[model samples]
Target: MIEDKNQQRTQLSDLGEFGLINHLTEHFEIKQSSTLKGVGDDAAVLKFENKKVVVTTDLLLEGVHFDLSYVPLKHLGYKAVVVNLSDVCAMNAQASQITVSIAVSNRFPLEALEDLYAGIQTAAKIYNVDLIGGDTTSSTTGLLISVTAIGEVEDEEVVYRDGARPNDLLVVSGDLGGAYMGLQVLEREKEVFKVNPNNQPDLEPYTYIVERQLKPEARKDIVQLLKDLKVKPTAMIDISDGLSSEIMHLCKASDVGCDLYEEKIPLDPQVISTCEEFNIDSTTIALNGGEDYELLMTISQDDYPKIKANPNLTVIGYMKASNEGMHLVTRADTRIPLKAQGWKNFND
Candidate 1:
């Protein structure tokens, strides 16, 4: 019994980063001709009729990705789909189908699963995506959800992270940083609950911020709107890892640079107020907080008027020569170096 127990206790840390990736893929055999590529790029590339398809997945684990104390099951389910769809939209493709796999502890009853699935179905209908298949499993700990979304686009219409050209205008849809600030509010409420178990947290005032955190919408409409307007993004990425980190990704992949205008960073008023309440810099939160699920893209300079004329888009900056580096021009008329403060799960 002792020997068996010892053999089962394999620490994940023993295989770090590349070691883990190699270990996970070691036994996986590519058995399908349709799987043109797998597991080694921004998105899995697949060859189809006369077009290409991209498939990507994301996993969310309770306690790590979310706290059940504040996150309702329904909202959690909706968010899982939203995050995966964001990745599909990042590649400038229409997300058509998704498979949702979930593992939950026995503590949750059938009704709880129904609540979760309700949100999933709602998202499917809203995004006009189909739910093909998935699996359910039992877990001894908290809940785990893994979602794989499949999308397709014509070969030429597929905008990738590596295609930004110099002189392209950088634009973002909606606002940033509200979700991060909303998280701060939820955490504070959780702390308060710990101190006074009977105190019902008054979160009525933080409706916008709370909603931003709990239920983020993927920019599917933006994709359709852009197409209707005849605007083709040179390169694109979803702002799931914060603006600064994503900008760096586009810059590195395109071998270009960016100069973002701080004054132009679209931020919600509630995010600004919440940042003030928490004594956090709104600009920093907007740049590094992540999880806004907004679209970040670069368009040709000639298309600037198209984006400018439309109220839905904001021109934050533009791509430049690689040697220029990424800089943020503040409203104070000062230029500051942009830094990527993306979240590191290892620190947790």
Candidate 2:
């Protein structure tokens, strides 16, 4: 049993499925106008008026996608929502509502589930999204969370992976490699704890990166920033599967090639230092380390000046003709084929 003395631990069987759902979701109030009907329904009813609705779903498993030893249930719930919202934002839309479903083993108490919902509530409040509907069920193994996010955008404002054109500038929002390096630090600490269970890890130095891994926010601001700047991305995708893999996905979908500059890829100072401490290449980490939740997009040259001075965005490279192929130009001036080594659930 997980230790929590303040709250009384209750068994799942005591409340039953419907009772448990009501107890947990009682506080979640519908805040979106599009949500015509939310919880306590056979299915959620939504109305989008003249706007185009965007929907995305993601499933996170306990051992495969996350480690409970180092991860908090609240942070896990927030992340589960954010990852799906990131997908909706990738399409340049404003997320309005989310449906969360969880499968949990009997080992988790009602209090533990409350902690998880607390996180879900926090994220909903911060992102301004409503918890429209969801389901809860029993699991024999561990915890699994599935979130489906719904968003809205005008038909003209929506961006897709296939809309990029040749000569468009490749821009990325915020920094990279920090989340991947943060995972490395957490994994190392977990190993240390396994060997000596009493060891107290000084995680202060790795706080930024660790938080980047554990509690990443989607790039919702980038969408707003783009709108404010009156610039529309020709193509866009969120960096959930690492920079290299996501870039390749854009290229393939748009039928174009790219020249990603290794020197130009943004890296946080902590990521660089952590890479040195671990003797791992920072560029490789940036390329293959996924789950940053930042936005990667292509913009026409005409729109370049608008974003040129923006500190939150970085222009890393440019789209090329399909014949050029996708390659990364290293700091040494050597060109290598860009490769995708993003997260693979099957391999895990």
Q: How does candidate 2 score on lDDT?
A: 0.93
For candidate 1, what is the TM-score? 0.85
For residues 35-62, what per-residue lDDT tens digits would candidate 1 score against the true structure?
5665555445455567678889999999
Task: Look at candidate 1 and tell me the lDDT of residue 146.
Answer: 92
Task: Tell me the RMSD of model 1 versus the true structure.
Answer: 9.7
lDDT of each: 0.83, 0.93
RMSD, each candidate, Å? 9.7, 1.5
Against the true structure, whose lDDT is highest?
A: 2
The C-alpha stretches of model 1 lying farther than 4 A from their native spots are 1-49
Candidate 2, residue 19: the lDDT equals 100
Error of 2 at 39 (Å): 0.5
TM-score of each candidate structure, all chains considered together? 0.85, 0.98
Superposed Cα deviation of residue 95, candidate 2 (Å): 0.4
